[model samples]
Target: MPEEVKAHITGVVFQVLAKPGDTVGAGDAILVLESMKMEIPVEAPRAGTVSAIKAKEGETVQEGDTVALLE
Candidate 1:
């Protein structure tokens, strides 16, 4: 099954650390979000290959929004 990597806080996408076909471990940072002067990572929920990233660099994302898909 596929899993979602969601933003924990509303913020602008600071960076994208992984791309489609990238293999990642559990808790690996998939992307970073800049909120309130802090950089937060949106991480993979489990070990998987990155399927897609919906949020791009500098894009604003809301809390609980799906930023990436993992399979």
Candidate 2:
């Protein structure tokens, strides 16, 4: 099954941390978001392998937007 990793806040992607084929644990940050001069992490909801990254660096993402896929 595939799981969607979502952004918790509206922000521009500051950096991408996990790439496709990378393994991550629950709460692992897949990317960083910059909003209001602060950097926030978009984390994996559960332990899984990264299948895809939908957001790129400097991309603007809204809250609840899918940032990555986990399988």
Candidate 3:
């Protein structure tokens, strides 16, 4: 099954740390968000290979928006 990494808060994407085909562990940071002058990391929900990134740097994302897909 595939797992999704979602944004926890509304923010602008600060950085993307994982790319498609990258192997990631549970809790690994897939991307970072900039909100309220703080950097927040969006972590992978499970161990899997990164299948896609839905958010890009400088893009605004809402809470609960899917940021990446893992499989």
Q: What is the C-alpha lDDT of each candidate?
A: 0.94, 0.95, 0.94
What's the TM-score of every candidate structure?
Answer: 0.96, 0.96, 0.95
- Which digits, one per residue and each the tens of the lDDT, describe model 1 over residues 1-70? 7888889999999999999999999999999999999999988889999999999999999999999999
- Counted clashes in each candidate structure: 0, 0, 0
Position 35, candidate 3: lDDT: 98
The C-alpha stretches of model 2 lying farther than 4 A from their native spots are none
How many clashing residue pairs, candidate 2? 0
Predicted candidate 2 versus true structure: per-residue lDDT over 18-46, tens digit per residue? 99999999999999999988999888889
Give the Cα RMSD of candidate 2: 0.7
Put down candidate 3 lDDT per residue, 1-71, tens digits, no spaces: 67878999999999999999999999999999999899999998889999999998999999999999999
Residue 62 displacement (Å), model 2: 0.8
Which one wins by TM-score: 2 or 3? 2
In lDDT terms, how accurate is model 3?
A: 0.94
Ranking by TM-score: 1, 2, 3
Q: Give me the displacement of residue 1 in model 1, in angstroms.
A: 2.9
